[model samples]
Target: MSLTEDAIEKIIGKFGRYQTWILVLICVGRIPTEMQLSNVVFIIPSVNYVCLDEGAFNATNYCPCKYPEYDTSTIVSSVTSTWNLICDRNQLASLAQSMLQVGILAGSLFYGHVSDRYGRKIAVLLSLLSEVVFVAISAVVPEFWIFMVCRFLIGTAVGGTMLCCYVMIIEISGKSFRPYLPGLIELPYSISYASLAVIAYFLRDWRHLQLATSLPWLFVLFYYWLIPESPRWLITTGKRQQAIDLLTYIAKKNNRPTENIESLVIKIEEQSLKENEQRYGTYLDLFKTSKIRVYTLIMALVWMCCSHTFFGINQYIGRLQGNLYLNVILSALILIPGLILVVIGSLYLKRKLSVIISFSVAAISLLVFIIIPSNMENATLAFAFIGQLGAYTSFVQVYLYCSEIFPTMVRNSAMGFASVFARFGGFIAPFVVNIGIEWASITIFSALAFCAALLCLMLPETKDTVLLNTVAQTEKNKVVVNQEST
Candidate 1:
């Protein structure tokens, strides 16, 4: 174990009161992320429309309609209806979602650096503040172009917030607690996901639903005062006193004796210096060693596969045969069992095996969903649910697996770098789902899932392993694992 983990074990123990409190706060804050990402499904739903100008409509079936009447029994006013995004303007709806993914791509890379340099707390706060400001602005924007820009900005903040929160949770907890903690934190995400369906069902109008989701984030901003920076990050950057103070604070809150806290911090500081000869690691360092470079590439591909399939399935839910609200609710509810499977994987299975199993499940289920006849609505929906279950499991597990594989020095950078590919996958998902033939999209998703599972075979397992603090340790661990396999 690294000195920081030892200090946490000795001084704070695992699952302490302070840790539990912060975990709850962080989980609650995560609610908005899902809300923002999935909101597009409802906010720009497909609505039936008729062109007002009969001559132009008759002349060219694809002519732009200045005013189109929309059926509003189900959804009163959405981006589709408000902007007349029908016929020639239909592609704009998908463009709005794509812009959000582009923003996430930018934010993940930007905030990964910021979190590594400025500290996790500041990055998280900035992300929250940005989400609130832009999401609220998005609610009232008159023009579709302006709203698309806001969606982009909101995606950026969501990316940063998610990356920082994930890193902080792993850094603060002990190894024994690491696996289960992600599952717990994701609980609120699932609930928020389901609750959005309920909220949107009542609001009917896109603007009202937007406001309802954005308002709760105002309360989450108080996290600036409540959450603390990671002590491990402090020690790595040569902030010995701050690290000690935070550790002491954790000890007191957990009712652990702090009489030896100073000495423990001193030891941890010296060890950190010895382990990490370089004080700060950069993205370039990720490619310094061959093994690390290979791992980085494989992780990027895995993340891409996971993101593409997960978001693709989410956006495709509306097209499924059923009540849109019920389909979304069922999709969200299915994720709970997937999360439980992650917990089970953490306790009983190797990291590689868990990811492989998840990807295989997704690939097989999606393939089955594709082969089934379209007219069999009940069978198709059941299979779609199963596919989502697998996709979600792989998505969540990849976050945990990625964190464990990379060293602390470049963990956030690595995560951000990998997430760039993930977001890229997300960026294209809307187009794939909306433009492509339904079976083609499912086949593509299934193929990628199978490829991702195969790639996992090349990477080393990280279950029950100590989180390494430096690049040298990362390379060394890979070598050890390779020798053991041989």
Candidate 2:
């Protein structure tokens, strides 16, 4: 069966009232964002453990903590000495956390497709429950391989959750609130990062931390009761009665009554029953359309540059100079202003203008860090701080634009389509830093700057009008927006 433009229009029309103010207030729904943050922080210590590997650096000297155990003491060894079983080395530990991202790169596609097929509520529940189990198991894994496997399983859970929550909020929330609600998920990262630091301060051991982190996922079960099934999805699946009931329930909750909900339901069902039979293509369809191909590829480059630069900069700072925690604190601090600017820019200014200005400024700031002589320690700190801010802002802006521009049907898959480039960036960033900085730090950041500049050329401006309302609409406006000038 062929899908019709009329069906797509009906879907959009059904969502149009979602943008209303009262509806936005009522649907201020939150997913399990904090739980995921705890997991991230739980994993970060191992990621940075190379900072204290083999007891090479005295914790008291650099840390000034005035305590021995405040460090990654040979304590894992101290305890394991009494037992036959042992935790793995630094390499395995780091790889354990990273393996999950590997799992994410692999699983994001199928996870997203499944949600688009069956239902958002079910997908999110399954993802969260599976994550809780795997992450908990990972905390207790005796064998190194089992731990890695569990960690990878947790990654699969994350892939599912990210896609599901995004689709769920947009699909269920009123059209008025979609942009703001989605923006909420990203801007709250500062709070999440701060919470992680505080939690890590209290729970120092990686295993205990992992358990502490995984525990909140149990609370995600609350979502089963609170979060609604996506009405758009119900409509898409031809569950018209369910959709009408859900919509009526929402109307009642907001003090607005649906007078002809029964008639509306019958009419919508009759209209859609013939139209929605066409099976959605695989995630590969993200690249199948000429217009989608351009959109996906450009976003891919932006993802590649942003992830590569961020990771590369972190490694460069960790190895070359500067304090680890200080850099992290500074980076986290920058996120506040970055997020504020994103909210202001995305709402008030042109979305595409923000994207260009963001990437271009990031490129310029990075160049400043590379070219300028930084004899003073504070100067280095200031430069890195400012450069980080620019990069962070650009990163947030790009993600927001991505959410806006893609068609509703393939949004998650389109987002996932950029995963390969983003993952490649993660893979290549450290290598590039290690090799490129042999000549100078300037050379290293210059590479990042260049990628930013080049990627900016491929993006389309999405400041005004509705985003990608139809296939023809998406295809027509896809002339790449140049990042250098406008």
Model 2 scores worst on lDDT over the 10 consecutive residues at: 77-86
Error of 1 at 384 (Å): 0.9
TM-scores of the candidates are 0.95, 0.75
lDDT of 2 by residue, 406-472 (tens): 7555666776666656656655554465453443644555466566657666666555333332333
Q: lDDT for each of the candidates?
A: 0.83, 0.56
Best lDDT among the predictions, by candidate number: 1
lDDT of 1: 0.83
Model 2 CA lDDT for position 472: 39
The list of candidate 1 runs beyond 4 A from truth reads: 1-6, 55-66, 479-486
lDDT of 1 by residue, 191-262 (tens): 988999999999998888888888767987688789999887887778888988998999899998988877
User: Model 2 clash pairs?
Assistant: 18-174, 18-175, 18-176, 19-175, 19-176
Measured with C-alpha atoms, the lDDT of residue 229 in candidate 1 is 94
Candidate 1: residue pairs that collide: none
